[model samples]
Target: MRLLLLFFTVVLGADESFITPQEYAAQLYHNPRGIGCHLCHGEHGEGKVIAHYIDKGEKKAFEGPPIRALDFRRFDAALNRRNTGMPKYFLTAPERKALYRYLHPETVKDAHAEK
Candidate 1:
């Protein structure tokens, strides 16, 4: 019985805890390597950037994707991308949960908010 209880505790303890949006944004901004969302998405998540190349005689800018940087505000939309250049992440279950927490933060207090 004790062993079973311990196993249950360990398993249940692994479940993700809730986090606010601000905290999530902070984590995204200050990743250990200093390469947070802003590194690619822009400081305000605005998806704006300076032009980097010229293609077909047209000046091409480095604008982020139309979807914008993993807009946690739109979790469903973000997850639907089939071939975004973003890394595969190779995240574990807990890490994925943490990412979800960051993206779909509970701070908005509006579970029904539109993207």
Candidate 2:
């Protein structure tokens, strides 16, 4: 089991050398390990209206809030907080930073795109 784990880790780490952080984050955000952020947040973290319904006999809209513009601290806090309307990902710090980079590529330092 340990040998298999080591082999997989080595293979994945090798692939990482060619892929940019943004690519990794894009895959995570779109496919996650489970529920996709894109389903709620849209392709660019711009957020989307999920559904329209009647509440208290009044029409209401359920929408995902915009995330791209949030500062890193606020973004991290939101991701870490429990009871978020979204599911808990329990993402690692680097993963969170990568997601932030995917959302705001212009603000981030150089993220080399894999050729």
Per-structure clash totals for the candidates: 0, 0
Number of the predicted model whose TM-score against the real structure is largest: 2
TM-score of each: 0.43, 0.78
Model 2: how far residue 13 lies from native, Å: 9.9
TM-score of 1: 0.43
lDDT (tens digit, per residue) of candidate 1 on 1-115? 9999999887777643344445544574446233455555555545546458989999877655533345454644343354354433333444434445544455346533422
Stretches of model 1 off by over 4 angstroms after superposition: 1-21, 32-35, 66-82, 91-115
Clashing pairs in 2: none
Pairs of residues clashing in candidate 1: none
Cα lDDT, model 1, residue 111: 39
